[model samples]
Target: MRVVIVEDNAVLAEGLNLLLASSGFEVAARTADAPSFLAAVAEHRPDVTVVDVRLPPTFSDEGVQAALAARAAVPGLPVLVFSQYVEQVYARDLLADGLGGVGYLLKDRVARVEEFLDAVRRVAAGGTAIDPEVVAQLLVRRTSPLARLTPREREVLELMAQGLDNGDIAARLVVTERAVHKHIGNIFLKLDLAPTDSGHRRVRAVLTYLDA
Candidate 1:
């Protein structure tokens, strides 16, 4: 897949470029700052764009704004955020339009090459791969509907928000698939989420609402 990277840190940008190259992905472009990043994406339209949460000028929410604008210019362009902090509000804003092909992941997760690639691939395939930490932060708000979930239910929902299926979450938690299903059912009830086309999409909508 062709990839575009938007990270201000020179060292991290080089490292990410090398990582993507070694993984057999074409590095279409590498840039920092909002204008350049958006321009690169508009010019190359890479299969996926890996962006950091902060960039030049402010180093606060420039990356987030760029990502949003890039997507606005090219709807469903498959953007994956690589950030150290979990800004739940930004996550919600990114998904405000309910557009798929998006991912919000922690920068620390890059150490796990396979997992990072999985998230990238998932986003490219029009799936959500939200960070569990992002979900945790969203759940912390008192107004979060997830506040009604039990501890186990919350754990299951957290994994689900990461785009994991019942089987995957079951294996991760070392529990039976049936137990995972049961927890999912309870989760739907607690969150007042109605069933959708399939498992992951429904859970993704719930997670989106939590972030919203």
Candidate 2:
């Protein structure tokens, strides 16, 4: 598949280009800024675009805004979004047009070459590959009951969706496992999940969130 990459970090961008090249895909164009990024799309009209959520000038959500622009410029163009952090708000925006021909994955997933390539292919073929972390993040405040969670709770929720255990989360957050457990309980209760001890709750929650 022909693809374009829009990432501000030169090292990471070059690395991804080589990876995509090695994976038997054509790198039609590469740009680190928004203008050139959009130019490449209009010039090449690639089958899929591998876009970073941040870009030059602001290093914020420029890439995301660019993808939205591309959608307007060329309807049905597939977009695969990669980000250093998982932001559900951005994911929702990208998938706002109904979740087809779009993917939102964590940049770390690029290390798993096969999965990364598969995500590209999936989005190009008109499918969604929202990271489980993103799914959980969106679910944090979606419950019927209102729970005002702190930023730390949101971080814990993001980690939890990655299938991390309480101790593992504690180590990552540099907190006690009890804190993680309390966060999980609050999340489940706020989300109005059925009372269940089975681990399938997360899975079920993810599936429901994605389908929504």
Candidate 3:
């Protein structure tokens, strides 16, 4: 897959470039600021983009804004936001479209090659790959709708938001796949998400958890 990287830190950017290259992904472009990142997006039309949450000039939220804009210009553009901290507001904005192919992960995750690559690949394949910490922070809100979920149900939802499948959730929770399905069914029912909904139930459920 072709990938574009937007990071101000030269060392980190180069490292990521090398890592993706070694993993057989083409590093189409490496940009430092929001403007350049946008330009790269238009030029390379990469299959996915790895962007930092902060960028040059302001070093505040330019990266996030650029990512949002790029997706606006190219709908469903896969974006993996790599940040040093968990900015819940930014994460919410990225997932606001309710479309998959989105990810928000802390930069620390880069140290774990396998996990990081999995997240990238997942997002590239039009899936959500939210960081566990991001999911936890969002879950703290627990507003109406979500408030009806039992504690175990909430746990299952959290893992689901982290982009884990039924098997993965089962392994993580040390439960049977059957048990995971039961909990997911309960979650959908409690959230008033019918099986016939147009969207994927798992994604819709996770969206509910995030939107809560």
Candidate achieving the largest lDDT: 3
The Cα RMSD of model 3 versus the native structure comes to 14.3
Candidate 1 residue spans exceeding 4 A from truth: 109-111, 141-212
When 1 and 2 are scored with TM-score, the better candidate is 2
Q: Which ranking of candidates, highest lDDT first?
A: 3, 1, 2
Cα lDDT, all candidates = 0.79, 0.76, 0.84
* Candidate 1, 15-88: lDDT as tens digits: 98998899889999999788999899989988898989767775656787788888889888888988885544
Q: How would you encode candidate 2's per-residue C-alpha lDDT over 69-184 as one tens digit per residue?
A: 88889888899888875443455677778634998888765567889989999998998777886666566645522234566766777676687878999999999989888877
Per-candidate TM equals 0.64, 0.65, 0.64
TM accuracy, model 2: 0.65
lDDT of 3: 0.84
Q: Which consecutive 10 residues in model 3 have the weakest lDDT in total?
A: 190-199
Local accuracy of candidate 3 as per-residue lDDT tens digits, 21-52: 99989999999999989999999888999989
How would you order the candidates by TM-score, starting with the best?
2, 1, 3
Candidate 1, residue 100: lDDT = 61
Between candidates 2 and 3, name the one with more favorable TM-score. 2
